[model samples]
Target: MANNFLRRVDLIFDQDCNFKDVLKSTYQRSNDDIINELLESGLKGRGGAGFPTALKWKFTSEQADVEKYIVCNADEGEPGTFKDREILFKVPLKVFGGMAICAKVINAKEGFLYLRGEYRFLLPELEKQLAQFQSILDELKIDFHIKIIMGSGAYICGEESALFESMEGGRGEPRNKPPYPTVSGFRKKPTVINNVETLVYSFMIFRYGAHKFKELGTADSRGSKVFSVSGDTPKPGIYELELGMTVEQFVEEFGDGDTKAVQVGGASGFCVPRKRFKDTIIGFEGVPTGGSMMLFNSSRSMYNVLHNYLEFFEEESCGQCTPCRVGCQQLKLGIEAVKRGERHATYLEQLQKLAQTMKITAKCGLGQSVANSFFSIVENFKEEMIY
Candidate 1:
């Protein structure tokens, strides 16, 4: 397990440019082979959902010959997820290379990096890196050019469809699914949207064989994952751990001695208390995360944590849909009411039921995932809310 523990795909991380030579070999192979390699690697999107990267590529590739686009979601809006920001700052070429490879597979001539507005400071340097990457594409004669699209600091735009809407110069509200991004996206063209880490992993998986990449992680979740650890951790920083490690293992390695609960994603993820940490695995099999692991010690207040998260979601909701806008408000108020003794304990039960309804009926992932942290924190630390 330790051998697979720190399996860093260091080609891009440490500025190893040898990946260009590896990509040159891919030009001779057919697109199907490349896509199939991704399929076999069992790589999933690192952007929370854990959707199959290969399937996204396959669907977009199989679409009718039209103007297709590849989008890299660099909108690192999640509270604790800054891994994408680091990748965008340091190893942008890996992102470009991955996008180029996806373009080659899906026959897309253009790509976009939807950068979060908070990261606008990194733009000047990123443009310089992209210019260098463009020359490499020119040398390889790959007919792909990546453009940078800056988001206006809207957290809802982190959703692919909302990002698409923002790219089109509209308000960033999520579109309904079924005609998902693969079929109709970004000006109604077939588009493939991947998070920053997912694109980098795609680059590595293509260079190293799928079997080699598959050797690292568990059966359910393949490949190593980059976790951004914070909050009461001794070593609070970015960690590249092989997926499927128990929460207990992670806490033991990084916790600041008195860790009591762990938030396994950002505000929109699950909270694992000390009792469940021993059995909890941080992967798709147990609790899948989009690269955030915030450890909370016993000193922290669960009510305050939930309040902070609720405040974030409340302000970030696009307000276009009633369920999200109104539901988030009610959740925040319900928790506050409980904390202040203004409402009976049964009020929380009503809010939980409402949260269940929101999960089923909300517009997109933002609204749907609000219940995750709400329920986890409230259910685990009920005493904190009441008294």
Candidate 2:
């Protein structure tokens, strides 16, 4: 009930002035100061991983590499998620300012916003706004620059390494991690990959100071997050909520009638039955903060929903690795078998084991999290899976 950064969305629209200008004026500190403030604030990545943002920047900043890069992962291919799209269209300048600040902090000369291919309609509009921002930067003599790279709509590219490969004009398949993007990303330079919402918050953190930013959200999860609620929700758009808001409150506010379950964090995120929703809260502390929530009512068929999700994964896989390519194929086959009442209980057990193995052995996050939706839905709603 208390208003914090969650309600800033309303303020942004209600106030007639430019939100970018307000942010620039309010948070325009030197790069060093901004980085220090962010470190103190304990801001973690709002994207799926929830890595500490300050530590990520510190790693890149301290690295002895000559070339450094910052990338905004705007490739929002996760089903039921559209928060990044809204930010790109509604608050383009803030996204730009955040990237500029990130570049300055890491002393990176260049940045890129890797947008999904489906966002073709927004490209021209983004280009126009970007040009306007460029003029302002030129007048101000800022040395940093950003290019908008369009993705081929591959869900795998949402993974950082895959995004890097796509930027290099190759197929959008994921690469091996450990040498990670921080040490060797984007043409073999140290790079920082952040979500669109995470970068947008950077401008706010830089402007308002980290301590003030910390004042809003929970202790561990320290910020507000934007969730794109779809499916059975009545107001099925974006809602900015504090990190720790319970799922019950979220569902009651926007849920359609007779809500049965909710999927937090997107296609790769877990599904919670109505009973679990009451206890769960939004944030990286417990539940994931992947920025997508699809509510389901009793009227909705769990099998159909999961089938749709699996179909998405089957089509979007980059097919570079055997586990992902073959595993996803097997999963799809298993789903079809179950649907047709041809799968034995033993086959279902095998699918579960395969899901676990894929989580641990997959080449990247795509293969790792791919089975999440299936496993969660099946485990929680076993009754629905049977004829």
Candidate 3:
């Protein structure tokens, strides 16, 4: 079934075949031309925020610097978002190809794949692929070296700044923005940080040009999205589908059962009840997410699921700021209060208000978006929380 999905998308990954050929063919253009083509195609970042990839490259490339770097955020720490891991294990070379293209476009001499520590077993396979990719680069004379940096299993490290800190051998915690990674990153050099899937799309955009790629999905959100569909589903796995496909269509494709709600994005993603699912489209404009769809049945306890998510947030937060460190603690405690039926209704309301504040004022994405799962679940499934 997975193979069928890959074939449908023209993905060049399969069990019997390694991706050396795909990588070789994807690099058929000069760096400048590839950048121009990407800009013309209008490819946005695949990793949630949907920032323009070409503009990001242009900005990073224009920085007058002797040394620059491109870092792939392979730290797929988003709970229920396993697309990156699937790509790593299956179509690694395509990701490498995209990284190489990014390096060349941004004039970066080095690239790093900052993979999650939980993906330690895939490291040996990645190392082997990197060696082969090095040979491919040498054959093509592409003048850049890429390295794989394993994260220490911290969810905070998935944030670009924290990932940089982890790469630099520091405790994984976010730094202040304004000196965003592009301006000052990776040993204080100009850097381009992109998610793993975003880099893979870069390969496609440059290869087929932007227009062909844009034909797949919505005007605002052009191209297909890879989703890690799990939780209370008969066929739970990674699915690559066009953006703008309604949540209803998605569930139908997966052989619909009693889906009470669907969580878009990851643990930090929003929850849409069955009613809203029909209106929900899969893209930045709708959910503003990274395409991680986790379904929940009516039998599933919304309270229990929320509790599990809170536990994850508590463990994964980098303990950097008062908002994330203390805020997560308070949220967890509040959930516990609900579980034990000890909190007043007003306390839940207070927790919701605090989450909103964290979303607005938190220093980094971790704290800012960490409240999404809880708030969305609470808002959409209020009856479940009423005890």
Best by lDDT: 1
User: Between which residue pairs do clashes occur in model 1?
Assistant: none
Model 2 TM-score, 2 decimals: 0.93
lDDT of 2 by residue, 185-291 (tens): 99979999999888877777665567766776788787677888898877887877667777777777777768998888887888888888778867765678578
lDDT of 1 by residue, 144-224 (tens): 899999998899999999999999999999998979999999998999999999999999887877987798789999988
Candidate 1 has its poorest 10 consecutive residues by lDDT at 3-12
Instruction: lDDT for model 2, please.
Output: 0.80
Residue 173 deviation, candidate 2, in Å?
Answer: 1.4
Q: How much lDDT does each candidate structure score? A: 0.90, 0.80, 0.80
Off by over 4 Å in 2: 1-31
RMSD of 3: 3.0
What tens digits encode model 3's per-residue C-alpha lDDT throughout 1-387?
Answer: 432322235532434433455455556657677778788776788767788888888889888998999999988878788888888898788788888888877888799999898999999989998999899889878788999988777878888888898899999888888887778998988899998888888876655667877777777777777888888888898767767777777766663579888888888888888988778877767886786788888899998888888888878887767787788889989977875779876688899988988898888887888678878898888768767
Candidate 1, residue 253: how far the Cα is off, in Å: 0.6
Off by over 4 Å in 1: 1-12
Candidate 2 local Cα displacement, residue 62, angstroms: 1.0
